[model samples]
Target: MSELKAKLFQDLSDAVVDMDEEKTVETSHRVIDEGIDAYEAIEKGLAHGMDRVGELFDQEEYFIPEVLICSDAMYAGVEVLKPHLKGDEQGEKKKVVIGVIEGDTHDIGKNLVKIMLETSGFDVFDLGRDIPPQQFVDKAKEVGAHIIGLSTLMTTTMDGMREVVRILEETNLREQFKVIVGGGPISQSFADKIGADGYAANAADAVRLARKLVS
Candidate 1:
């Protein structure tokens, strides 16, 4: 039983990193038959793989295409195991509000961040792209999210991130939710200037920085 369980984990990890959709589904069933805990298989095996992929991305060893496919594999495995997840799982996960700030139509980065957060068991409320500053504050308040992830690909749109921070400050909610900033044109200096709680260069770094901020 232990050997089977271990193999199932290895297979699941391979599926995620390799982005093998069929293999991901196949390994999920093998996990059930092998008697491995479903959540363990997901959190430890699948999500862990994605996390590693994220790290590789941070190092530039893997690009967006690799990250995208790996995320797809992670989701495939999650879909198979979703039904087996505990009923109370919904309330146990952390809630996050994510969006691309105003004047930015670049969603690829935002979407990647959402996938990483969701795969890591965050309840992501994606507000999509070109969102106004007030919308971020309102959504965070409504969803009771502890983390607000802002994305922007254009330097011109980076002001939108600062505006979101400004709104949060004006609303007195700046201290309530941790803010993380990311995108192609954003830097650590930019995050510091905008009063953001954290800055990440890539999707993986975003998850790591977010965990640190919220934790």
Candidate 2:
């Protein structure tokens, strides 16, 4: 990369880590004006920044509020770069259907997974919170989604994730999509018991799991 291009990417990463929304937006616009490759800007710039945010989160150097702010800054840059993505880039993206299971209103984890999935090149169909089991199956079928991600933060609602797998099996659609579960109360053992294809303990792992599922 040229010195100027490298600096722009670094500036984009710094803006997200700093949670500077205005600078993020400005840098994104400059990237577009300079005809920088949007995909590279997103991956090498914004996603690079969020990767650090994840590390900070793992070390407890960053909390929920700080991560949320970083996400906001990252998204501001993404909005500017999205429209410029090449047709082939968009065409090659994988599809994911994600939602929080029924009887649970918690969605912070689900939202984080969605954002990370999108940043990692998955086209996510977010069903939001309190989604019924059939909705997940139906949406996955509708979109030809490769993965169905279910999340619940409560023990009571964790059973809802199992129900989703059961419904898909009964419909003979279980083989059509990979089922991945996550949240505060979920685990690999729980995922195996529930017949889910994979489990993610957090947002970054969710992305890796999604990629592995589709791969």
Candidate 3:
């Protein structure tokens, strides 16, 4: 039985990493047929595969397109398992606030981070793009979020992240949340300049940093 379970998990992980939607769906069904726990399949299979994909991304082995497709497969598997995840299981979620900073309309990076964070067990409050600094602060305060992920594809919008930090500092909320910055033009140096708690090169790194930040 352990071997069978391992095989199913391996198949599911491979399907997600391969970005094979049909294969992922089939494997999800196979796990169900085998009476395997859906949460185990998600945690041990798709989530594990996504972590590898993130590493590949960090190493420059995988690019944005590949990450997108792989995340799609993982989300598909999650959709299948969503129905079976228990109420108690659902309530243990950690909240994360995410959005693209002001003057930025690009959502590709933000969406990727959102998917990766959600897959890693964060309940993300996505504020969408073109969001002002105050909006981010408001949402984070309202949701009692521990992590605030800011995405910006334009250099022009990088200042928005700084503004967010400034606003938080003024309100005694600076220590209330960890600020994580990302997007096309952001770097660890930039994060340091702006006083951000963390910076990730891609979605997976964002999840890693966010987890550490929240913890």
Candidate 4:
């Protein structure tokens, strides 16, 4: 990329890392004005910044509030760029219903996954944190979703994931939707035990797993 383009992308990334919503909006407008590809701006700029934010959270350099603000900045940038995206970039996308399991108010991880899924062209229905297991299945059914994404950072709430699976099986909807689980306390064995289709380690991995399950 040209120097000017590179600098603008860097600015977009930095705005998110700094949690500067105004600057993120301004830089995103600059990206559109400068005729840069909106998709690249999202991937290389906003998403890149969120990746850093995720790392910070992992290292405890950034807490829940900071990460949430950072995501707001990134999302502000994304909104500015969304309308400018090419039609082909938004081809038919599989619908996914995602939310944190019951009793867990922590949604930083869920937010990250939503951003990644939305950016990757998946139709994501985010139910926010502290969601009940039945709600996930209900939303998936309501939206004709192909996937149900369950998340929780707490072990106590992990049972909610299994509960969702059980509910789906009881309702005879288990075969209709692929279930994917992830979070700090979730493991491949837990996912297997719950009869979920897959387990993702992070947002990017969730996107990949969603694609593979749908494919």
Consecutive 10-residue window with the lowest summed lDDT within model 2? 100-109
lDDT of each: 0.85, 0.89, 0.87, 0.87
Clash-forming residue pairs, model 3: none
lDDT of 2 by residue, 1-215 (tens): 99888999999999999999999899999999998999899989998888888778778898888988998999999999989999887777799999887534557888888877876778999998888888999999999999999988779888889899999989898899999999888989999998999999988789888988888
Please identify model 4 stretches exceeding 4 Å from their true place.
Answer: 91-94, 104-122, 129-135, 141-144, 152-160, 167-176, 182-189, 199-215
What is candidate 3's lDDT per residue for 1-215, written digit by digit as tens?
49999998888888888988888888888888888888899988888888778788888898889989998998898888778777787777788899987544557888888988987889999998889999999999998998899988788878999999999999999999999999888999999999999999877788879888777
Question: Which is superior by lDDT, 2 or 3?
Answer: 2
- List the candidates' TM-scores in order: 0.90, 0.92, 0.89, 0.73
lDDT of 3: 0.87
Best by TM-score: 2
Instruction: Give me the runs in candidate 2 sitting further than 4 Å from their true place.
Output: 103-105
Task: For model 2, name the residue pairs that clash.
Answer: none
Candidate 2 lDDT score at position 134:
87
C-alpha displacement of 72 in model 1, angstroms?
0.6
What's the residue-level lDDT of 210 in candidate 4?
A: 94
